[model samples]
Target chain A: MELFHLVLRNLLARPVRSFLTLLGVVIATTSMVLFLSFGEGLRRSLAQELSRVGPAIQIVPEGMEGLGFSGYPEITPEEYRRAVAAGKDLGVKRITPTLFLVRGGFDPQTSFFFQGLPEGVAPDLLYPGIKPQAGRLLPSEEGAIVGAKVAKRSQLALGNPLRLSPRVELRVEGILEESGGLADNLIFVPLKPLQEVLGTENYTALLVALNPGQKAEEVARALEARLPGLKAQTTGDVMRFAERALRISDLVRFGISLVALVVGGLLVANTVMMSVYERTREFGVMRALGAKRGFIFRLVVLEALLLASFGGLLGLALGSAVSQAINLYTLGQVGLALSAVTFRLSLFALLVALGLGLSAGLLPAYHASRIPVVEALGRV
Target chain B: MMGAVRAENLGKRYRQGEKEVVALEGFTFAFPQGSTAVVGPSGSGKTTLLNLLAGFDLPTEGGVYLGEVALHRLSEDERAEVRLRHMGFVFQQWNLIPTLTAWENVAFPLFLAGLPPRARKERALDLLEKVGVLERAHHLPSRLSGGEQQRVALARALALDPPILFADEPTGNLDAESREQVASLLFHAGQERILVLVTHDLELAARAERILYLKGGRLVRQEVPGPSR
Candidate 1:
């Protein structure tokens, strides 16, 4: 017990050095936690948005890749109507086809994904209801449901007529709630007018709702077999892609955190080595008083453990605080919030930090124990 | 009476660079237990002789027996165990752990012995009171004056009540007054335990049971103090 106290006192002798080393570990750990959290939050947000629509499959025409960015696809009216007809024949409950505009279809404008729902259907029936800041949406052929972002950016109001390219005009019927999703920038329109403006009689992509007892996979296979030169996708495909992307993103984040942890471990090792070197005479004194080599080994290792454990705890607290603050800010601004931004104690990260600290103590402890007792006492 | 320390043709040599330097060669001595001092100027092998008897350094040739144990034959670890379990040492620097309090320093041997905390602390306090440093028990070695540190060291040497205590110039760094105080404490402890002291101070040597004078790594003279009985 006295020896332990002596070891602690020796470490605490140079207050500034010990504190600075601990602070270094804290900062490094905090950065690692924050970096991983940001990646997790983004991935989660993407997944949430994709899962909102009730398992609808979207089919975009080939060579119309930019339509996803700014709803403009080069599909002839015949092909669009054919795809919709094929979707209807596959026992689908509904086939809603629409046009999408990109970059708000004008210069210095944001892009929106505009899906045209069938007339007389409740707008909320097919998609999640929009929390309107100003007006309600009418379920009519001429009525339009505008994304909250588009309303805010274009400064359009309810009952206002907004003109699109090729002489298509839309009446704003309702505004949506801020969902922090792809829909935030989207503007819905009537299918006929949108197709007329693009000089097409067909939809750019078909949104298929399968009949009851019909799985999405079965319906997708049916639609693909029926339509030539057209592809069918289910919600599961999009989900799988999203999952793969998230896994890759997580791997990258994990790699970065690992590098930082290794660097922190090296810093700990260097600090312990320097401390042992500086306290050679002190170790000698203990050894001359009949302290065994194992005693010196444990003392130095314990000192390292003390320093690193202190740093680990401080880092965890700081990182958790920063992550929670970010989560709060995100919830306030984006409506969707992250539950945890840092590695929760539920994870194994805290244990990993302790293991790293112990590993760093190995070489320095060995060196301390091997110092000759005779040489130490000679100085005495 | 049996000698507290007996060396038989003890020889110690070290490889310095390319040549073997004999620190002590073919030396033999035995003195009655109590307070015996070995006095010599620097390089007279005073410390070398002490190291051999304390079972710290191995003799290159020949042997030393401390309390019937052939110390030179023990392994390094065994020697260290013997030191912890049976011997106590004091040094010129007073060699107190700078961070520990006076009482804690006195308790160090018991800690090495793995004694229970309560027993160790009790023994430490008792030894501190015997050394007349109980008031300074909680003060660190750095906080104490040189004389106080040496007194604490004396208490530490008596912590385990070892039969033999070896000190190399216990008061070498103290002023005259502090030196007297430290030497008196050490000599007082010798009444019950054998105290083998190595020093260059002839005045301090005169108070011992017998004094052995060394020159050029060899014992050149022997003197019995107190009018030679």
Candidate 2:
């Protein structure tokens, strides 16, 4: 502990060098934190969105996974009939076929996610416990219900006119309560009118709901076998696929961070090596005054660690602040916080910084300890 | 042999590039307790001899015995331990740690000896007061003038109260008044211990009870001052 105190004093003596070294570590750590937070946030959002879904399985075009908006709706009316037939004896509660469409970006006024269910199918079939914060769910073919975030962002209220195109017009009959889930970002429209807007009569996907004791896995397997042209994914299956994709993204992010981390290591090494070089004589003086080689070695190593620890802490703070700022923008645009700095990530980054310190400090510490006492004292 | 240093035919050789340069050769003497000075001109091996005697460098030939320990046979770590526990050093440049305050610098050796913080501070403060730099106890070495830094270095060297104190041109960089003050402190502190000083200043050498005069790398004359002050 006493030796450590001396190390702190030694670093304090050269504040400029220490601060510059610290900035290197901070930049690396902050970049890493910001990069990985996206994975953390996506994982959290996906989990919440899945939990809010009332159906146990989603059958979409082979490439379209879950409710994600992608590719044109290609499930023919015949395939939809086969999906319903596959679940006939499987104790299926409801197999609601819906159409999904999305358009626009950057401009909230022009952007929209439109979920089209058969007229009078009730939004509760897809989103359980979804309460109308104002008015009521779409009660007829000429009205729509807006998700809470969409209503707030686009400044829509019940009785406001919504024009999907010049030919398809509707009134906002309801505004959803914020569910803190995917339901908070969708706009529910009647299926027939949406088909008219798209000029296509094909459905998007089938959301399969099973009875309390029914097995979703067995039903999904049966549907895939009967309707082989389409893919049936259980809630777990969708999550796993999403998670796998996320892991790949995570590896890419970590790979990018490695470069910054290496630079950080070099910065720390350069600062510490320079310190060791400058203090060679001082070390010799200490050696002559009864300090052991280990003493000098430990002093150098401790200085590096102290520098890294301070930088790592500040980096975590900076990363977290920047993450919230990113989240603020995303929450406004997508109604989802797309970056989260988690506790585990914080711990991991700090440990990595310390590891960097140890690695960077070792060679210099060895050199410092090996200098003969006489040479050091003689160095003036 | 307590509080005594025995040099057994001490010699040191260095390879300067391709040529072997002999810095010291065949000089053997048992320095008894109390003060002694080694006086020589430039390139006369005073510093090399001091280095070997203090175990800062190993002798190429022969050995140095501080009390009963064969310093030449000890490993580097063991020699360092010996220095920490039983040796003190003062140099021309003072060599006080620039980062530490005057009293902290003095307390450092005590700290290496595993002294507790409170005890280290107390002992350091007492020594600083004795050296007349108590008021500058908390001032860093850079903050102090050259004379003050040297005084603090003196206090540090005396911190362990070891039997052996090595001084190499302790007053070489000081003004006359500072030199006198440092020399006075050196002699006063060396009265009961074995003090070995290397210097070119004949006046400082004459102050020691005994002086060895060196020419080149060999001692040609040993003189005893008529009376010790």
Candidate 3:
């Protein structure tokens, strides 16, 4: 206890030196924490966006290319049945058959035709639910769902009826929940109706769900073997390709975060070095008084920890406030966007901050510990 | 029997370029359990001898026995342990730690020895009272006068209640009256320890149990007093 007060008093005696050193440590730790937090957030966002795509296995027709966006595949009903039977043989579950088309607009005003989904196969049932803005989604064969933003722009409302052709009429059921994602521009209808409009009684693709712990690759290989000329792709494989694209975006964000952490380390190192110099005499005295080399090492490191912990606590509070402010501004005040950028201090960021603090002090503290006691005493 | 220091042919040397300057050459002495002074002119190796006795410097040859242990054979840490448990030092310059208050400085050795806070405070206060500098206990060394700082240094040297006290120059930096006061305090401070002082002041040395005058790093004169000078 007596020694504790003595060490504390020695540091406190030179408040300016101590405070400046502490400030440096804090800046470094804060930057490290913020960067790590950003990386974590980006990783989560990327994963979330990837999962937004439909199930792993998208069993398209033989030699059917450019299934996404081009919106057409020439698979017969017999081919779709064959693929479903092959997937069933491979023990795949929930094989949702979908009829895809790229015909002209369901409305004469738009050039884009709605994508078609199988009966009882809800687009909402895809990996990420296609949430509806207002009314419930389409029931079996009665109504149609439109992306909320598209519906709003098109001035369409629930219960409104639309005529795609002289022969087909469908009631607007619901506006899909805006996923600032790809689902935002989509239109969905019953698979049978869409297949009929495309002049076919067969689906262009089949989406399958696997049992937990079953490898998608194994299932897809089995399905491919069971049905010749049919291509079987898992949700993971599709998501992987999309994830690669997302990784590029994430890498840029992560790079910025990495730079921030390095800046933080430099800040801490500079401050702690200055602190060690200022406490030279005090350290010398401790060494002279029979304090072992390790004691001085611990003391200097403790100083760094103290400074970093203070900064980390402050940064956490500040980060939380910043996140809350963003939430308020984007969600409430401005109300111009679908979602606001939120700040989250994940456990990973907290641990990274702790690591930064510890490492930042290590070299400087070691140097402080090794300073010759005699030279320090003479100088003082 | 209870002598504070016992030495047998203690020697120390330093090398400057190719010249080996002998600081102390096989000097044999004992400081009995009472006050004693070493009076010698400047560059007489008074400080070096004090350093050797205080366990701050190692002997190149021969040995210094503080109480029962041979200090020359001990490791640096072992030497520090010996100093903490059995010895106290009052440097000629009164090298007080600048950051600590007078009382904190006085209690430094006790803290080093891991004494509890309350006990350290009580003992430091008690010693300050004996040294008559209790009122200046809270003042830092820089705030205290030279005499006061020396007195506090003296009080600190005695805090562990060591059996031996080593003062390189107890009154070398003080004014006449303050020197006399510090000298008197150094001699009469209530303790059953031996006090060894290095001084160039002959009158001050005359007050010790014995005065050894050093010339050319050798003790050339040994003066025994019949009464206090």
Clashes of 2: 1
For candidate 1, write residues A156-195 as lDDT tens digits.
Answer: 7788886766477778888877767656666777767666
lDDT of each: 0.74, 0.88, 0.69
Question: What ranges in model 3 sit over 4 Å off?
Answer: A2-7, A42-80, A89-94, A97-122, A125-136, A139-173, A177-206, A209-281, A316-376, B1-3, B135-143, B175-178, B225-228
lDDT string, candidate 2, A117-219, tens digits: 8877778778898889998975578888989989998899999998888999989999999887777888898987778888898888888999898888888
DockQ of each: 0.46, 0.58, 0.30
lDDT string, candidate 3, B1-229, tens digits: 2245887787788798999999887788987888878877877778778767866667787888866778888876677677777777676667787878988888888877889889999999999988889999898899999999899988888888877887767788899988988888888752357888888888888888888888788888888987545
Judging by DockQ against the true structure, name the best candidate. 2
Clashing pairs in 1: A70-A101, A70-A102, A71-A100, A71-A101, A71-A102, A103-A111, A131-A177
User: For candidate 1, what is the DockQ-based docking class?
Assistant: acceptable
Q: Which lDDT tens digits does candidate 2 get at residues B67-161?
A: 78899999988888888777788899999888889999999999999999999999999999999999999998889998999999999999988
Stretches of candidate 1 exceeding 4 Å from the true structure: A2-4, A56-123, A126-134, A137-139, A148-156, A160-166, A178-186, A190-240, A250-267, A332-339, A342-349, B1-10, B27-33, B62-78, B218-229
lDDT by residue (A95-207, candidate 3, tens digit) is: 77766555455552354346677666667776366777877765448578877655766778888876766677778888787666545656678876666565667666777
- Stretches off by above 4 angstroms in model 2 are A105-109, A157-170, A196-201, A214-227, B1-3
Docking class of 3: acceptable
Best by lDDT: 2
